[model samples]
Target: MPEPIKVLVTGAAGQIAYSLLYSVAKGDVFGKDQPIILVLLDITPMMEVLKGVVMELQDCALPLVQEMIPTDKIEEAFKDIDAALLVGAMPRRDGMERKDLLAANVKIFQEQGKALDHYAKKTVKVVVVGNPANTNAFICSKFAPSIPKENFSALTRLDQNRAQAQIAGRLNVPNNAVKNCIIWGNHSSTQFPDVSHATVTKNGVVQPVAEAVKDDHWLNNEFIKTVQNRGAAVIKARKLSSAMSAAKAICDHMRDWWFGTHEGEWVSMAVPSDGSYEIEQDLMYSFPVNIKNGKYTIVQGLKIDDNAREKMNVTMKELKEEREMALAACQE
Candidate 1:
């Protein structure tokens, strides 16, 4: 067997982590042949809960999970880690504004980012899964200057998967039949789900998603709003934020990133922009990206209609405001 890769997961005792850890152990994130040593971290108060989680992993006897370390120490958890998932953050409660939540998470990511910079392998890939993920990712990357900006990304795949599923359902096709769906800009409600270039396969025939759905009115209004607000709808229905689907999306994101996307296919990731589509540089913004040889390139040359441009601007504006708030917080 190959040497076990050290994988660190923050917020190890939370609902999302609960689902994520098991999937990783089962080789859902990493390939089946690759072994992993999981380093699980949480706050001191949650150490006992983290221990219970470790015990359960032990009970499963998953061969891919070569070793498990549960700790409250960031340095200990991140030491020589190959990949880190920043999943723990203060969830927005009733009456909490976006800026308020961003402020609270900024402090957490800043400290954790420093630990990652000091202890993790320079090539470590970090995915920020916490709320206000795009901004949290930017804050973490800001503190970890030694790491390449390309090494950090936010989890926009959840939004992308939701968009794909919605499109497939509308066209009465299997989920795998949908390709090239893009979730652009922030992960918040201001996000834009673009199917303008997507294609769907039905009855052994492939065609543009717009052609398959045949309802521009629904696509423009209900589909975009539904994808944007799906998280809130889940919270309302489940009495808790989405756990399983979120974890699944994280796995999907990491898998595609590490394993590469299929030829001619792209996935959505919130990566540092290089001024593509006129987006500002250095912001972790969602774009359609194609991966190969463990590197990603933003998909280029797609025409952005006036409506899509309007939606993109709205989310970009929100992200810029959040970036300003994060900068102010860092200075404070």
Candidate 2:
């Protein structure tokens, strides 16, 4: 067997990590033939809960997990890690403003970024899954200058998955039938879920998703809002933020990054922008990206109609403002 790749999960005791770790240990994200070491990190107060999770993982007796280390030490968690799923961040509290939440998380990610720069492998692949993930990822990349910008991404895959499921449900087809569901801009409600470039395959005949749904009003308004607000809807129905689905999306995001997307297929990832679609450079913005050999290149030359352009600008503005706030917080 080859040497195991080290994967780290922060907030290892959290519900999403609870759902994710089992799948990862079973080779759901990385390939089944590959061996891996799991580094589980959380706050000191959560160490006991994290230990229970480690015990549960051991009970499963997963063969691929060569070693498991549960710790409250950031440096230990990040050291030599090949991949990081940054799931831990301050949750928004009742009556807390958005800026306040950003201020809290900026400090957390900034410190983690320094750890990654100082200890993690230069090739470490990072995906920020916490709330305000796009800005958080940008902050992390800012601090970890040695790690290539392309190596860092945020979890827009969940938003993409939600868009696909909504389309599939509307068309009464399998979720796999939807292709190229693009999530543009931030992960928040301002995101533009563009079916303008998406397609639905039914009976092996591929048709544009808009044509299949055949409801422009619904597509332009209801579908967009539904995809953008799906998280809130899940929270309303379950009285908790999504866990199982969020875990699945995290796995999918990492899997695609480790392997590669299929031919002519693209997925949403919030990667640092280099002025794609007029989005500000250095902002972590979601774009349809195609991956190959563990590297991602944003899909280019997609036609953005006037409507799509307008919506994209709104989300872009939000991210710009978020970056400004996060940077200002760092100064305080």
TM-score (all chains, Cα) for each model:
0.98, 0.98
* lDDT by residue for model 2 (204-250), tens: 89999989999999999999999998887777787777789999999
Q: Model 2 Cα displacement at 291 (Å)?
A: 0.5
Candidate 1: the clashing residue pairs are none
Cα lDDT tens digits, model 1, 4-119, are: 99999999999999999999998988899999999999999999888899999999999898899999988799899999988999876544577888988999999988998899
CA RMSD per model (angstroms): 0.9, 1.1
Extract clashing residue pairs from model 2: none
Worst 10 residues of 1 by lDDT: 90-99
Give the clash total for candidate 1: 0
Q: Give, for candidate 2, the lowest lDDT window spanning 10 residues.
A: 91-100
